[model samples]
Target chain A: MTSPWAVIIVVIYFCILGLVVGKWGKGKEKGLNEFAVAGRSGPWWLIMFTVLATWIIGSTYTATMGYAVMSGAIGIYMAMYSVMGLIIFYYIGPRIWVWGKVHNLYNLPDYIGRRYGDRRLAILVAIAGFIIGAPWQIMALKTFGYTTTALTYGALPEVAGMAIFAIAITAYCVYGGMRSVVVTDFFQGIICVVVVIGGIIACIYAKFGGIGPMFQQVLAQRPEMLVIEDTKYWTSIIVASFLGAYCWLEIFNRIFLAKSVRDLKIIARGAPILVGTVYFLVGILGIGGSILASVNVDLAAAESGLLTIFSEVGGPVLLAFAAIIIIAAEMSSIDSQIATAGVVLARNAVNEFKRTKLTEDRVVKLSRWIIGIWMVMVYFLSIGELPALIVIAIVTYEFLATMFPTIIIGALWKRGTAKACWASMAVGWIVCGILQISPVTQAWFGGWGAGITGAFFAIIVYFAVSLASPKDEKVEALFAEVEAYKEAR
Target chain B: MGNKLSRKSKTRLGFAIYFVVVIVPILALPTLNRLNTAEPFVGPFPRIIFLMLLDYLLVCAGLFALYEIESRRGDLL
Candidate 1:
């Protein structure tokens, strides 16, 4: 399932093209607003595309397909949570936008800092966010490296794949910041969906004839996978993923990029279609790959199993597009992470800690430098790759999942105090981390205990601590102001 | 009959629809879809995949209606 050098060249060409598109999208704004959130006047289309591009990460191309091949319909949890999450956001997003708009909040920790008037909590969460994103960047780099090597049939070294995309993404992220990320996402998102989905169709047609026949073949050979085997794990994954959907710094930042609450509503209405299509294609590849495993077991389980299937059937031409599309998706993801990490570190955490706050220009300069530091961190850490990258991704999601109670409650409940948030996150992080051990997760929870159960504990601790603590009048007034802002809008 | 519903009622209805959409895929669908594990094929997809697709479509239509309903001024309050 090796592709020719032509695929490698095409991938490189497209990466350069994406940089040009990103620079074009970067516009001429110099302030923090323009640099961080594309001036917060992003049209519905820009926000929609950027969200989709970031949402469908490299794993959806790689590991999720392997999961689908291993277990039937399990990856639907991936799709299910995404759509269900919108149900929460459709209601919650506007209020977040209102809060962000009203207080000039830059990111989620900034919102927390203002909401509770607690700088330490904000700094802790900000630092935690930057830390949580570490494994994520490594995972993305590994997936990038794996897919390029697999697609090129070992012509392209794994390190080269990681280095190529990481450098290009970091360059644009440093140069243009959020504006470049969103603009390039708009460019890459289109190529990703069209090429990846089209490649999926080509693979199905080349192999199992189509999705139904592929499923029929699998059902005839191994029907166990076709049915939901473990209901508890399945439901738990869906719930955890749904709760965790908006917990990412990039996701929270994307809400602020929307032009209006009306645009947020539009995003809510439209995202299920885009995200659903992406996941739906992943489902087809997974089901089809499940059958392919009977023919080629080892390749079927490879991290690039999905793209390998495309390369095997759809051939080098489709593999080139596949390589390009994945790079597009990966850059869309990594660039956002780098941009947000840099901004949060500089503006949210560093400036707050300073005696005299850094000027806006100095903050932007510091942010760019932080982006470089983050890329270096990825380079050093990813040198020793994790055995199971998706596992790291799940752990990354778990850390963010612990923040669910703080975010959802902070937005809605007036009584939610800073003390409650600290206690809630502490309990949630420890529970989730303990449950994450491989043997315990497998024996006790069947697979997905870390996130959903951890969130359950965090929610309880948040409520108990909130009820026990004296209600802060300042907090009550903050909620009143949030409500007033919503009304005035 | 639908036109007679007030804005308050419409928002409530929207929330109810959203609640159902969330509950189905998250809580109900996996268990319910497993009731028939014979793996029937439905329109180019297996039964489980078909159910997921159906659930996804329901969210699309349901959310769009909610958007239309909530886009109105009084519907949110």
Candidate 2:
């Protein structure tokens, strides 16, 4: 059943990507800045693509696509939440970038550490972020397996496929670090935009005669696909993603990677249009996908929409391309995660733990080793079956949502104290952690997510303690520094 | 019109506009978040899909407007 041509095609694609990425990512290993954040000089267009590529992980295609197939247009709520997140980041992110640029920060927790002038709070945030973030890496690898196995027509076992990517991604990230990830992201993002999204639109046009006719069938035959079954679930998930905009460590680094605040603003204004349009087109593909499949299958139901569309369209070349783009999307995300974890471990955990007097190069070297080990460990863990991939994704989102209240208020409000930061973050993280693992998903509380409900406590405590708590004397200087940076620019 | 407004009032207005943009779909749930009742074909889509499309376009446009205001005021960073 394995297609010799499919393996040959994917291998050829990888070879080309490897060569291009190697060239761009070369000479970037000389400094930690190049490795961690691409020396903080990414243009607006590259930042826009890389940010979208990194955010739209494999589960986005698989799980979110599956939701769209089942729930109809309501499934586009994933894209909506992301749009909300980007918009929120539009306002909040540039200010954080100002602080980051001044302090030469790489990670989200690093900003928190510097903002509160508390190294320990940074450590607390980093450790929690790492714990919650690790599951996503695992989940993506499982998707890597599913996509590879399905695409290759069983040419290779899923474990072999996962191993191939785990090794390949680890090699490049270790070699070129962030530069390689960003370079490869441009490739992946392009294919995603050109091939994957383009292919979907082409399917509706060529197969169904046009978009209108395709939806006419959906309207006429699969009308239930358009109905909103759980409106509350829809509202809650979008709100959670909106609030947890920057909880993602990769997105946090993307903000720092922008060339300047203006470039970031351009990105904030422009990226939503591009990415939102991509999702809108892809969302339209879902209705068509449902028309192609039996409507009432489970969430992880039937073969992927792309697979069915391409296979039915009788294009092996197109099917292979879609599979590769999906795989490339997975690699883009996992590479960012591995790259971030390595840097955070080196800067926040290793150096801060002992207050090590190590040189910056030494720290960078340490991170390289950590990146290798982290990937190896995740690779080994990824070889197992994980039917709960979507569950892990949801729980991870809830955990990261806990970081929102502290991150926003800490960056915005002058009265925010290091004391209040710890209390509120601790309370939010603990309560959200409990609620995420519990049976219900805050079903009774206006249909919001467990994470947002838990964050309700975080919000109250943040405001209450912020009002009563004594301010850190350094906070005024920090605010002054921000103002001076503003005036200077 | 822009020069007379204080930054605090501008921020409050920004938040008010943002919440409305974000929640407009929720308001639509009672009416538009249903099957293709009012019209079966809103061009290429069912009525609901068109509304969802309008909702996110609103989101993108609304947020960009806020960003422009902040950019003009030198408050983006």
DockQ of each: 0.44, 0.50
User: Residues A1-489, candidate 1, lDDT per residue (tens digit)?
Assistant: 343564766757675776566558676868888888888888888889888866798777766776777776775667877887876677677777877887788788888888888899988888887877778788788777877776667877988888887787788888888888888888778778887777788778778887777778877887776777677777777888888887788877888898888887898789888888888888767766766654337544644666567667756776677777776777788888889989999998889879999988898899999898879779767878467765676787876788888887788778899999999999998888888764466456445568887888899999999999998998777667755866676
Model 2 clash pairs are: none
TM-score of 1: 0.91
lDDT, each prediction: 0.77, 0.76
Q: Model 2: share of native contacts present?
A: 0.59
True lDDT of residue A467, candidate 2 = 88
What lDDT does model 2 reach?
0.76
> How do the residues A296-401 of candidate 2 rate in per-residue lDDT, one tens digit apiece?
3655553377666765664677777777867887888889988998998888888886754667788789999999898888878888666786578678777677
Q: Clashing pairs in model 1?
A: none
